[model samples]
Target: MRTEMFVDGKWIGATGGTFASVDPATGEVLAELPEATEAEVNAAVDAAARAFESAEWAGMLPAARAHVLLKAADLLAARTAEFAQLETRDQGQPLAISAGFSVPNAVEHFRYYAGWVTKITGITAPLSVPNVDYRTRREPLGVCALITPWNFPLMILVWKLAPALATGNTVVIKPAEQTPLTTLLLAEVLAEAGVPAGVVNIVTGGPEVGKALVRHPKVAKISFTGSTAVGREIASEAGRALKKVSLELGGKAPSIIDADADLDEAIEGNLMSGLLNSGQVCAAATRFYVDRKRADEFASKVAAIAGSMKLGSGLDETSQLGPLVSLEQLEQVDRYVQIGRSEGADLLTGGSRADGDLANGFFYRPTVFGNVTQNMRIAREEIFGPVLAVLPYDDADDLASRANDTDYGLAAYIWSRDIGTANRLAHQVKAGTVWINMPPLLDAGAAWGGMKASGMGREMGWAAIEDFTEVKSIWTSLA
Candidate 1:
């Protein structure tokens, strides 16, 4: 299928050129999408700005906005399978994961945020002067720019777009060029659900489309999810324009397996958590911390489960793991494995590509490495593969220190039987999201974001909805 850019509530051919999205499985062209130019990006932003400034939208009550948002949510939930299949083909995430996990997560974000469309509240302040009465009212931030990554395209798209729209702000989204099909399709869902034209739009392309949107004067705020390097560029541009920015960047998250933890349960969670989506997830648990006594046992179990995982096409009924997003990513993962071996980390299991039998697809065997130190290149950097680095620790304090040593802290996992210890360690770790015995993604109402180099700003929940809105103080005098 050929896809086009959404501008001013209509799908039109790109003025610049056309680009093809390839299926990572066999390197076949899945679809052709527009290479949006500077002009097209600016046009989408201008349309969103005009929509925001219009009395038709700006003057409407919160209830009216809520009605539209909820309607969109219902339509999205009904069409979950269609979006999930497209996502699996384009992004290389398993159809089961995309359908059972990502699509539903996206729909929840819409339905939950839909409820908040009319409930935005502001506080009343005590006045110093008796002649004046002051109160606050929340208003939309006009135009918002959303730039989502290739991994979990539909889910991350919801994370960026839901609150921006639910709070009554108009938005122009720039989904990753590699996998923008689901998002461009989502624009149709919004219209079908009753969201007005110009309220939402999708522009897809590489760096230029992203750069143009970020630097545009019409875009009041930007919310992005991608690599740390690209996030830096976007943040710098936003700084230059004095525009608001929210970023959910990269991570090399660590999971600690305490001595008092359930070894079997921990091993199971560790194996499946990172292997989900073939470990392309930003918050994927890549590093495993265990007591010295349990390191050997833990490594064996992790390797066994990983070795047994069914690897094939995302659409395969028995496939639990899928290919990486691209052949480029497969090469990157292999290079990192080589780096680990050269750095003296023991290759416990899976050190090569699975191209022997799966020659037609981009497939790498699930990898596990042992005898890893905190200082190794493999442990420190993000491999973005189905690779695990199991590190041994002597004490809890030492484990905590080592876990915090990484430059990225988007998410962390703790597998322990003791509630007190889990709660205590959870407080010490420097991550936006900390999981205790659970490695799955969270609900739509919880605030999800990262700290440090992982980027800033929170999305979801009541507070996150407010992130898309601006509060104004109104003062009146009654003489």
Candidate 2:
């Protein structure tokens, strides 16, 4: 295992010694990762800065850069199974999910952004002054710092890196301490694909390392995906430094089930949407707003479906739900379940950790709560686990009001047979992305992000490329 910092084209051991990477599924010590110190982080940022100024990286043609990204995608596809196993072992996601969704999506991001390499455009404008000519172009921001969360480490990392590199920006990545293994492995993928040394650097450590990256004077932009609290901190630091940034942060996303909605489809969607990845997903539908007429029915069905989900090792295909990413995450979910009960929300099912064969893992069975109110802590907070809060609404106006009540606006879902109602509600809902009769559908070409306290800026698509580039206008006398 590569348990060292990848800086300046080479892997070096951390000066701060090593830290253990435990398998969330079995609580076994999987590997010892080097705890990169502040010095190593600085080295990474400096390396990226140097690479951004180098001809080999910064001056590479767009088509040539695309070739490198495309090669990386091919290499990733070839090793999908190997990387998927590593992801499951480190991130506690099901092997099938890691292979089918996470790994492949990482590859897709690279390929999709690869197409954009030669397509990044410039604009020619008609100048107000007859004697003057003006043209606008986008240029790379050197030395971007990417901070990714543990839940979807590889995929989200690629989400930021693809566009940053495609736009010609060098980067320093700080993967979450819990799941830095696969990201460390990505260095090998990039190397074999012929990405120049210092173009992509990775530093693995705790929050101190992240803080250093965000505040580094050499870093030109910050792209972070994690909690709102942490995102805010990074944004504040970036603001002080006058650096560009993109944040994909927390979500208390709500799913609405109208009276005319497909109950079975909503139930199934909830299983995949709310409880998928053990509800560690930032965009997972944690808040449910069902029409009063079908609230009890919806709540009961959710409880039953959540209860039936099998919990075990991610490597086991039979296991529908894997363990929480860590013991700390497991405890957090348990605490929220208790808070839901204490706050008078009906605990329809599951409020404890799994036992027996699954006891060794950080596994918690899916939990569902009914009669949830907007005011309750369980409803208001981002639990980041497989706990659902189901609330009822009597009217359309009330449903809209309640759904838009929270400070978060990352994503929202609506299920209804009435296309008119769904369309209108989708427009009214306060979120970056809205899904109608769907389950959190995401694409590399579509922008993904949040509003309000959720986060700032966007990721994915051509919009993501815009964040990493600075627009410059050239003016000259033509007469």
Candidate 3:
């Protein structure tokens, strides 16, 4: 495995030194990775700025840039298994999920955005006056700095990279310290695919590197994905720099099952939506709102699924759930499960740490808490684990009010056969994305973001292309 920073078209060792990258499953040190310094961060920004000004890159045709991205996508598709193994080993995501979802989704993001490169344009306006002409041009925003979280490291990095590159902007990305392997590998792939040197740079380090990157005078835009606490700091620094910033922060998404919903489908959706990726997803459904009439049934069925889910090393094919990203995260989940019990919520199933063969790993069982109130910490906080809290509501109004009670508004789900009820709930819930009769799903063509304190701005689709580009209007006399 490569264990150096990529900058200015070459692999270089970090002056700030290196840190051990531990495998969450085995608690074994996988590699010693470079710890980037503020000096290195500045160098990356300078390189990107220089690249953005270079004739070879800045003057390249939009179609040519798109071709590079498509080629990169093809290269990644050819080695999906290699990338998947790295992800499962480093991040503790199940091998099947790493191969099936993370790697494929990363490939799809590049391919999807490739088609938009030439299509990114501004429109011409018709002027009423005879001698007046008006038109708009969309242009890249120079160098962009991207900070991606560890939960979905490879996929999230591509989410930011694909759009930035498609819009013709050079980038300096800092991957999360916990999971930088796949991202470093991606830089190699981009290089092989003919991405111009300095066009894409990777700096691996802790928060100091991220802070330096965001505060660098040369970076024109900042797109971040992580906790709201960190996002707030990023926004503050960006605001001080007068830089454009887009954030996709944390979420405590509520999944509601109405009276007329299909019980089996709801149970299945609840398990996957709340428990997928070991519930490390930012938009994972952590809070469950069910009809009072079906509350007990919903709790019992979900509990059964939670109790039976296989917990082992991500490399094991029979394992459905893997360990948390780290021991710290695993401990955090355990504390929250205890908090739920202390708050008078019923522990339906699976709250303790895994034992026997799984004890060596950072594994926690899929946990379910019944008799939960809207105000409970487990119901309100972003657990970031395979823990589900079930709360009952009497009517539509009650369900809507309870669902909208949290500070988070990233994603929400509505499960009802009745179209009218589902439509109304979809409108009432204060999340950026709302799904009806389905688990939360994301398409590259649709915009994804959050509402309220969850985050500001959007990612994916044409919206992201617009996010990376700035619009300028031109007026002329045509007499």
Instruction: Provide the global lDDT of candidate 3 against the true structure.
Output: 0.91
| lDDT, candidates in the order shown | 0.87, 0.91, 0.91
Look at candidate 2 and give me any clashing residue pairs: none
Candidate 3: count of backbone clashes, pairs at least 3 residues apart or interchain: 0
C-alpha positional error of residue 233 in candidate 2 after TM-score superposition, expressed in Å: 1.0
lDDT of 2 at 385: 95
Model 2: per-residue Cα lDDT over 1-479, one tens digit each: 57788998899986787878889999999988888888888888888888888857758988899999999999999999999999999999998789999999999999999999999988998967889888888999899999999999999999999999999999999999999999999999999999999999999888988998888899888999999999889989999999998888899998988889999999888778998789999889998998888899999988998888889999999989999999999999998888888889999888999999889999998999999888999888899999998898877777777888888999999999999999999999999999999887778999999998789898899899899899999999977
Clashes of 2: 0
Q: Which model, 1 or 3, shows the larger TM-score?
A: 3
lDDT-superior candidate, 1 or 2 = 2
Q: Mark the regions of model 2 whose C-alpha exceeds 4 Å error after superposition.
A: none
Question: Considering TM-score, which of the candidate structures 1 and 2 is the better prediction for this target?
Answer: 2
- What TM-score, computed on C-alpha atoms, does each candidate reach? 0.98, 0.99, 0.98
Displacement of residue 314 (Cα, Å) in model 3 is 1.1
